[model samples]
Target: MVDNRVNPTSNMKLLLYNQVDGRCPFCGKNLHYVKNQIQTLLEIAHIYPANPKSHEAELLKDVPRLSEDVNSMENLIVACRDCHKKFDHPRTAEDYYRWYDLKKELMLNDEAKSAFFDNNVEEDIIKVMDSLLKIECESDLVQLSLSALKLDEKINKENSFIFRKKIRDQVVDYYPMVREQFNELDAISPYQFEKIATQVKGCYLTLIKINENQEAVFRMLVAWLDEKTGKISSLACEIIISFFIQNCEVFS
Candidate 1:
């Protein structure tokens, strides 16, 4: 039988390496080593066998595939040569699922990271952050009852209990002030609040397209806001994201 394997392009190889952060996804070994000079030990392995023998094909016949196209980026991963060899010669259903799941995670992470470069929120969000920071008086904050919190409705079941609690705390503490800040901004400059809300919505849309997981989306929104606000305060960013969630700007 003719071998159908084809070498991935230079750009494809680079992308595979980057998706796994220059380490073997299977073995956690560095994809390259610099002994005398740079020596690459990475091998691109297909999640779905490119040219499977009859038995290999039968073993994975019922398993879901990342891509029908054998060499597509979705079906490829960078592994150390040892893992690549081991994964190919004796592929099992368990191994196939493991590799497929790992590749999917890496792809999602890459997409989330890429969104940081592709999208930017309005700078006015920083004003809201400043307002949050200036709340010197505990009486200044108006906490909403847990029954009124929107996070319970918007957060998915897949999210951890701790994350749910953290978001709940942020929203309960900061939602009122954030909403007030937006109201003040709108009163001062008509549509300024709308502009920021729309930008946050846009970022959320981009993130959901990458991964529909609520926890992942929420974390990405916080990270994106942190980046946009010059990394001033992660807590401030989380509060702002929680405000958006409550205001129906995201996770709806």
Candidate 2:
């Protein structure tokens, strides 16, 4: 995996990150927010060399309007440090083809699309959100979170059609509202989401100190299931616990 540090100046890095969902598209390594002290490993890589003096960039000189697009979203991608360097080395034409193949693989993902339609939609949401949190650039974090939500909604369009409609119809039940709010990030915007994440993150760290084992964490989480308040509270607690357990690795 590429471990090169990224510059704080570039918004394109984050934009590229949002495009690939915040991981190395080629190696599938966790790029965003994986470390504690050090900077992120993900960086913006232009498919066509951005430098006008470079041979690869020169090749595009004959192609109309394409050379100018070297810095455009269509031409930029997120890559790990190693991949970024390797992409710049030898066999420019062959590397471009290989890069294109990797790009296709990233875009045409069946698993991410299928998960949205499957029983694991919540898990999928958390996964994408986790990536958003891990991003090195803090600029427009909420915007990036919102984009991730929209991308998921775009996936499995046909499958989500009926359920999305049902969500639209059902107002009282959060089933629809939860999906809609997340899709739009309206009801609880990304900033609000970050606040919750911060609170929960503190709680999670405390839990680890108390007991590092999963069983201990589950028992503590189970305390809420016994709440005399109501079933909704219990259900909410369960959902929280499930998300924390499933993504405990995100923080560490």
Candidate 3:
């Protein structure tokens, strides 16, 4: 059979390697090996088979594909040789869906990172983090009734049950205190709360544009805020994000 697979350029290879962080997304093995000399062990695998055999084509015909063009960047991934071979042979619907989901996650992560540079929250958002960290007494924390949580209304069915439960728990634990802190910040400096809320909303809007999955956007928002706040507790970021969801700054 004539080989029709086009070899990826050096730049494309590098981009693929970087996207997987120099490791095989499937096996978690390093893409390179170094003993006597550095050797590359990575293979660019197609998320959708480029040239499926008759049986392979039939198997995947109804499966969702990342792109119609199998050679597109959206349909490529960096995998170690072993995983590449394993995934290609005996390509069951289960394995196809698994790889498809993994590639989609990687793409979402890359888009989220790129979007962070354009839409970022202000440093003033850190004040909320500081307040969370400074709490010395359990009495300082405020709780809300479970019935008051808006996560169900704000979040779509795309969100996982675990994520929904987590956001609900955080909102129940910190909603009132976070709201009070924002109100106090506004009192001290007029529009401070609005400024911070607007920045977060902008970031959320930018992320949703990349991927509308509520859980994906929520996770990206927490990650962006965590970085902006100098790597503060992710729990604090989650609480703040939940607060904004309640305030209609996000998921609205």
Please report the candidate that would top TM-score against the real structure.
1
lDDT (Cα) of model 2 = 0.50
Please provide, for model 3 over 21-126, each residue's C-alpha lDDT reduced to its tens digit, 9 standing for 90 to 100. 9999998999898989999999999977888888998988899889887888888999999999999887888999999999999999988666444333355577
Screening candidate 1 with a backbone cut-off below 3 angstroms (N, C-alpha, C), the clashing residue pairs are none
Task: Compute each candidate's TM-score over C-alphas.
Answer: 0.51, 0.35, 0.50
**lDDT, residue 91, candidate 1:** 80
Candidate 2 per-residue C-alpha lDDT over 1-252 given as tens digits, one digit per residue, 9 for 90 to 100: 443233434575555576677778878887857356756887777776655445656655444332345656556678898888887775366677677666656555634454333423333344333443344663522321322222233223443455434322222222222333344542434444444344445555677687765445545643533242233344444444433332332124
Clashing residue pairs in candidate 3 are none
Q: lDDT for each of the candidates?
A: 0.86, 0.50, 0.85
Deviating ranges (above 4 Å) for candidate 1 = 119-252
Where model 3 places Cα greater than 4 Å from the true spot, the runs are: 1-121
lDDT of 3 at 170: 80
Count of clashing pairs, candidate 1: 0
Residue 137's lDDT within candidate 2 is 66
Error at 158, model 3, angstroms: 3.4
Better of 2 and 3 by TM-score: 3
